[model samples]
Target chain A: MIKLLPRYILSFILLVFLQVFILNNIQFSGYINPYIYVLFILVLPFETPKWFLLFIAFVLGLTVDLFSNTPGMHSSATVFMAFLRPYVLKVISPRDGYESETLPQLKHYGSAWFIRYSAILIFAHHLFLFYIEVFRLSEFFATLARVILSSLFTIILVLISQYFYRRDIKR
Target chain B: MRSLLNFLVRIHFLLLFILIEVFSISLLVNRNSFHKARFVNFTRQVAGNVFVKSNNLKQYLSLTEENQRLAEENNRLLNIIESTYKSDEIFFRSVNDTIFNQRYQYTSAKIINNSINKKHNFITLNKGSEQGLRPEMAVVSEGSIVGVIKGVSNNYSTVISLLNLDLKISSKIKKNGYFGPLMWEGQGYQSAILNEIPLNADIQVGDTIITSGFSSIYPEGILIGFISDFTEKGGSFYEIKVNLSTDFKSLDNVNVIGNLLQTEKLNIEKQAEQND
Candidate 1:
């Protein structure tokens, strides 16, 4: 736990920087605003206590909100994702139960398993976040399109980063 | 009592989750409320400075484009000065110094953070109260209307962007002077709707739209956009589409217009209404 502190802290800072300075400015049209910052909540250790997970997710969402000027919006969506994270892990657990002493990562699970896990969470987060931002049901289909496109991009970005992390472990 | 304690303990995590979500949603709903004002200042102090550093790094990449825009504006001003100087018969009589009361003061500021894709978009400018900025000032790009100042901190301020659905600018047709209120429909950044133009007005596609100066904020004759399309589907007015002139994505430097006479205008109007 002590050794994992620096890793989580470093990723948190790096992801926030990447989000505000780069991905935010790259919002393609009004359709695809990819949010890869939610990756932090996606890859937390499976054994993380539920209450602690909710707190950390709230803090993470508020951090992104501070930069983007969308107060409360991101935090709510992220907390929702954090709340559902355990159920998602349980539902997708393999037949052999699970590998001992392993964090949720592509190295422990193959690319296929990791992709499925992250995709479900990312889809849920984006769907919830966009709807809340829109609030009104008038542009339902338009908001849905934004959700699908943004989720696709976010999933692709998450996979790319996971593969890169996997390569670093090989060294 | 033992059974109730067990139930409460069993659902503790769920209770915590609900509590956190309720707090967040309250924050969202009360975003523009007074309680969030102080929190917004905190956001301005931290996030605003970080944006300044990043904007400084990004500005270098667009130096040439920025210089070209500045040069073109200078050239246009110079041409106007030269033409007026050559054509007018000026009287060089000495006048009282008290006659030169300045009505408008312009403060040039750099945009540090801006969002064009959101329903309620905001722009963060580098200058703030220390730089002689106040809320309710109009902001404009090179020669186009951008947004209005919303909140000001010590060294940073936020702007309600023209793309925001909550803002409405008084505008008129440059060709025939048919005035209306221009508003964003939250559809796209490049377009807005100008409504309340009388149906009998001689309107055409591509006619220019300019500010009407009905309010104390924006001055008249500043170009808002060109009329892109219009329809009479509603009541007695034409719902005209306008292609906004300012490209919100590329806004870098803008001028904050301080209308010094706004207080005077409002006071007099209030006095006149009192007699009625």
Candidate 2:
């Protein structure tokens, strides 16, 4: 992803803008506050350096935190998700392996593969985020219900958003 | 030496990950206390400005609703003045009123950013320290209590919304004289849990909850919420849920309250405690 900084930067700004300005305002219910910005981490190129991946995740999470007034909550969750991304990718890799010609996009990798990949990371992020925000085990089950509901909502949002990203072959 | 260097290089990314996670978690843990790192304040300013820009576009959309609320509040104030006005009062009998001179000052602010869906919700206002705002001041909407100011920048301030789990406000049952600390239990934004009122307080379903005013933040008897549900739970105290009156969803403008006597009260109280 380092070689394609300009393209990723555009997506980064666009995704954060969408998350803070639009999605943050859309409260379907108190239980499910969808965070579609995790899509930025889910779509990183397969060959991204481990250090760079972690750095980008930290900055992205911090940006979300700064906007939402949850200082370290999003950053911690995003970094945890980024640290687990390579392992998740390895476990869910295609039998024929990733196509060098295609990045991790719904069109490139098929909807099923993309869903599995995004769902795992999104669920991990949401679970970590909700638990850490409460910082107590007293409301364990309620928090879990929230995590599960929000994760499902975020996954659907991430999937629906894929249709709107214009496929720019030049990038 | 070469083998050692290779192992260090191989695990360097793991080290970076650990370092960043530690830093982020430190910020989270540190936030539970009164003091925060300067970085968080800086970022809050940046975020506040962005929210102001965004809210500017949407300001017109809610103008009518906000105006109506303001008019309602004005009518209520007018009624209070009319009821208390004594045109035939003695001109020399101002002795009982001089002690009540301006105990609480109010500064109006516009809500620029707000979130109620989170376990820890916050409301950001467009007015900040430059507008004479300070942390720990009470924030009230119309005649009801909203939250307390938590942090303030030059141009913005963040409030720990009454909906947040971490906040607790001193409150009382208006029916009887019993008082308690009210806290949000992460139930929906409309409700919060009030504790420490004894079972014998003769409470009713629609009884109002108001600020105790024993604490210096909010002035005495400001409306907080009403008892929606109650049971004799949590030992001796009644575990009552209050239906918050301020519709946090539609909130636009609020007044930040500054208690002029807080410092003097605290100083005297501290001396008394030391003597004890």
Candidate 3:
């Protein structure tokens, strides 16, 4: 528990820096801007206590929000994803209420399950994040387009990270 | 009792998530006019440091073009300066005369980060509060207007770019002074729509547009853009498309005007509001 905590913290910090400094600079014609920061919440260990998960997700998102100057969009989106996570897991249960020792990964849940899980979470996060950021439906089509494009970019990046790092779960 | 305790513990996260989301949502809804200037300034400082390194790298590759442009500007200024001193002294006495004072003041800044492709665009400048920058100050480039300052920190501030949908600047026709509000239509980055101009106004293709000076932010007569096309919408107002003077997609260095009278005007207005 002690070792895993420090490792996750280190990676989380690195990811946020990479996100704000590097990925934030990448805007492909406004539509395909990816926000891979939320992957921190998506890949948390399954055995993580519910309260701890919520707290960590809030802190993670709030930290990014503070830096991006979006104030609260990321936190709101992240918490919404965290809230819906359990339901999503239940809907796509891996044969049973995940083994206590097992963590969510492409290897454990299969690529199809991972896709469904990540897609739903990413969609929910993007939808809420975009709507809140704009704060109105007046430009509904434009906002929807942004959400779809950003979600695709974020999902692809998250999947890439998951694919490469899935085997390194020491805990 | 143990099962009930476990159930309660399980739903605790759900409750916590909802609470945090509510707090964040309230923040989002109330962001405008929330006086988060200090917070934004701090964040911009952090972002500015990161961008400075990258902007330095970018400047290296574009050095030749920048030098050429700078040389041309230097030559033009030198010619004007030399001619002013020689033939007629009183005719061209001080460069800081009424003509120079009436139109604008320029302070160059590097565009560390800019967002042109978003529905609501914003640009970050390297110059900030430490450089006499303040909220509502106008920013422009050599040939075109860029945006107005929304917030300023000790070393950086965010400009609400002309491409932002929410931005509305007072503008008028250079030929006739038919004033209207210039706003983005959530479309192209290079173009914006000037609305509320009377249908009777003679707006020809390529008619010059400049700031109306009705708003305190920008001085009247600063070059904004040119009319690309115009069409009467609903037989009432002419919706004229303006090709922006500043190419936001390629923006690098910009000039931020430090309006000396801004705070005085704001204070007077605030006092009047209090009295009323």
* Residue B16 CA displacement from its true place in model 2, Å: 2.5
> DockQ: which candidate is best?
2
Looking at model 3, the pairs that clash are none
**Per-residue alpha-carbon lDDT of model 2 for A65-166, expressed as tens digits?**
888878789999999999999999999999989978578889888899999999999999999999999899999999998899889999998998787774
Prediction 2 TM-score vs. true: 0.92
Residue-by-residue lDDT tens digits, candidate 1, B223-247: 8999899999577889999999999
Model 2, span B63-166: residue lDDT tens: 88768877998999898767557543632344344455767888899999988888888999998888899998999997898999998888888899998877
Which tens-of-lDDT digit does each residue in B1-276 have in candidate 3? 999999978778767878888888887667665335555556678877877887788789999988988899899999987876767865555544646553445678888877665556678888887887787889988856899888877887888888876689999999999999999886767788999998888779999999998787888888888889988898889999999888787788888886666667778988999999
> What would you estimate as the lDDT of candidate 1?
0.87
Candidate 3 i-RMS: 2.5
lDDT of 1 by residue, A1-171 (tens): 567788899999999999988988886866488999999998888778999999999999988887776778899999999988989999999888677678788889888888999999999999989999888899999999999999999999998898788866542
Query: How much is B182 displaced in model 3, in angstroms?
Result: 1.2
DockQ for each model: 0.66, 0.71, 0.53
Task: Show model 2 residue runs off by greater than 4 Å.
Answer: A1-3, B1-4, B32-35, B70-100
Best by TM-score: 2
Residue B89's lDDT in candidate 1: 44
When sorted by TM-score, best at the front, the candidate numbers are 2, 1, 3
Residue-wise lDDT of candidate 3 within A1-171, one digit each (tens)? 455678788889988988876787678875457878888888788777777777887888878776565667788888888888877887888665787655677777788988889999999988988887666789899889889988998889888988787777654
Q: For each prediction, how big is the interface RMSD?
A: 1.5, 1.8, 2.5
Superposing every Cα of model 3 onto the true structure, what RMSD results? 3.5
